[model samples]
Target: MPLDLSRRSLFTGAAGLTVSGLAGAGLAGCSQTAPSGTTDAAFPPGAIDPHLLGPAEGVALLSRNENPYGPSQSALDMIEYAASKGAYYANQEAAVSLMSMIAEKNGVDPEQVVLTTGSGEVLSAIAVLYGPRGPIVAPRLFWDTTALYAANLGMAEIQRVPLTDEMEIDLAAIEAAVTPDTGLVQLCNPNNPTGLVSDPATFQAAVRRMAATTTVLVDEAYIELSDDPEANSCVPLISEGHDVIVTRTFSKIYGMAGIRLGYAIASAETAAAIRPVVMSWSPCTSYAAGIGCYNDDAFIDFSKSKVTEARDMVFATLDTLGLDYLPSQTNFVYFKSGLEANAVQAAMAERLISVRGQYMDYNEWTRVSMGKVEDVERFCRALPELIEA
Candidate 1:
């Protein structure tokens, strides 16, 4: 079936743009760099298809932020061992133990963390809990999933906040965008695509000024790769009794994406509020696998080291190309070509390599994920031709 990237949806954009108005326009005309007062939808419905690009046929450097090096051997061994228990439900004691491990690492109580299918699932849970018919504020240039998740909850009043020159969150603008109707505020720290991180002081100020009624969610999906995880997280906000949720993913630094484990750290009260909405049964076997994988401190440190190496390598390549990119603190880099990004992505695809497309700012920018060293070389080798052409 052909998917419709059209505006024929149950919910339309509020304010200046509608699903119908932005359907034919690129992301530039929408959130990323859309003119102020314009609320062009960032992603038209059904724009992405994982099936459209398969890993077996070619290297999908496009969504390459996925940890190319997956789980540690011990983690994989545990997964295989768990597979043998397929006939039975996993032990609840083991699952709780895994949750406790994550809580311990983050300095939170086990009861204050709720395990989910993945960090992505946690975002969905948030949308359902706070969205559906309210104004919400989020960074405009970001991973599209957050906005899509919000829209899925029937949110029509999605306000776009632009990134500052340094690619950090525009805290002043975010504070200004908040309205009484704003139900939630989302911050993707060490943000996806761009890999830019916000300083802690700015976050504190944002939380301080945010309407007391709005819940702030810090999606720390890539905090492990960041230079200062402690100073850049909102966990303190949750402890201070602010309405905050800090979501961490095992998929990235832990190399557990396939294992499908992520957890949200919050006040016990916030966790309790989200508990009823989480999927009651999250494939028990996966829980067992993640427990053993995340338990090893040595494995965690080693994985972080590797990601840091890849991040620095990619940044060097971007510099060599003279490509303008955000100073990445994550495993990926977002670059702007000052032209249509899809053209460059198509050019890379022609070489059997893929890069993500960005539709922001009426300019074409693309985001490339750092993979293994060899994959990075192939992408870099193919770049001059595309950029010069």
Candidate 2:
């Protein structure tokens, strides 16, 4: 969908105008004072150190595919404003407005959009709702975390199709794997771990063919980072009234992973079915952040450029080391390490860097997400030594 210039201006203006007013509200009576004598001193002796819960300082965290620069200034401003109203439940009108904006941006009816805590909610909801109908068909190796969670609970059965020899998701194989009893078809474009994007035309055509038989869920979490997000998205299929559901997340592009906001576009009926199964509601702060940065093209461009720069560093290092890697269209690179995956992971950890070991049976391959430039530099520097060792 085309960017709404008027909306962009409004967002820019709001970010600039709200600071003093929000500060005044906090300075006045809005700020809450915590009760006295309620500090960490009251905690039990065995309580885990909060620091241990996250990455250690100076560690190059390249394991999780998160946008290193995110929640743009506009989002931060909006989040501040939203926090002042934290005592109250999120305004229903504002929630509706966000859905409307997303609907307008994606060229779908508001009824077709169901907002959730994150796209993970959409995946789990789909699994619970449709998994019992039959088996979920998906590529053998993709981001199957949520699907696997549902399967463990006995809510779904998944039928996996192996990737092509080139490590690309084989749409033909996935299509052939789907039968009359198939519950849903799950696809992650610019698929996770491999980072290979399917041709948009071919992808859409294949989805349409599969949607003819059963619902198809297209997880476009990283579509915005792909070469052509508009063409790569299967969202238009929903407008065409196919049994297709398109999921998107502000977590990846907007850098709002901790904030937890995502949504799905489907036929109004499908959306309705999915909404009931969503486990949690996003806060007003997250909604405000989404509204602020959803149209901030400049920030998106900046983030993508940084990701590209970091990815290039990894690529150049891999080239020098004679390592094989797939040409990536997303924010991470999957490469053949020529050593045991766990060994490489351990070696990187010993060097105070983090990278994924393997996925499924690709034991000699590793996936490293793009981190901050300096952090990626650390990974690149350590990789050569690890490989040589």
Clashes of each: 6, 0
Clashes of 2: 0
lDDT of 2 by residue, 1-389 (tens): 33222322212112222333323222101134454555677556878545333456778878888876888999999999999999986766666788889999999877777777778766777877788899999999888877775676676888999999998889999999988899999999979989999989899999999999999999899999998999999999888888999999998878877777888899888877776666555788988988899899999999999989999999999999999999999889999988989889999999888888767778999999897889999998888788887
On the 0 to 100 scale, the lDDT of residue 245 in model 2 is 94
Distance (Å) between predicted and true CA of 182, model 1? Answer: 1.6
How many times do residue backbones clash in model 1?
6
Q: Which 10 consecutive positions of candidate 1 have the poorest summed lDDT?
A: 3-12
Report clash pairs, candidate 2.
none
Choose the strongest candidate by lDDT: 2
The stretch of ten residues in a row with the least summed lDDT in candidate 2 is 8-17
Using TM-score as the measure, the top candidate is 2
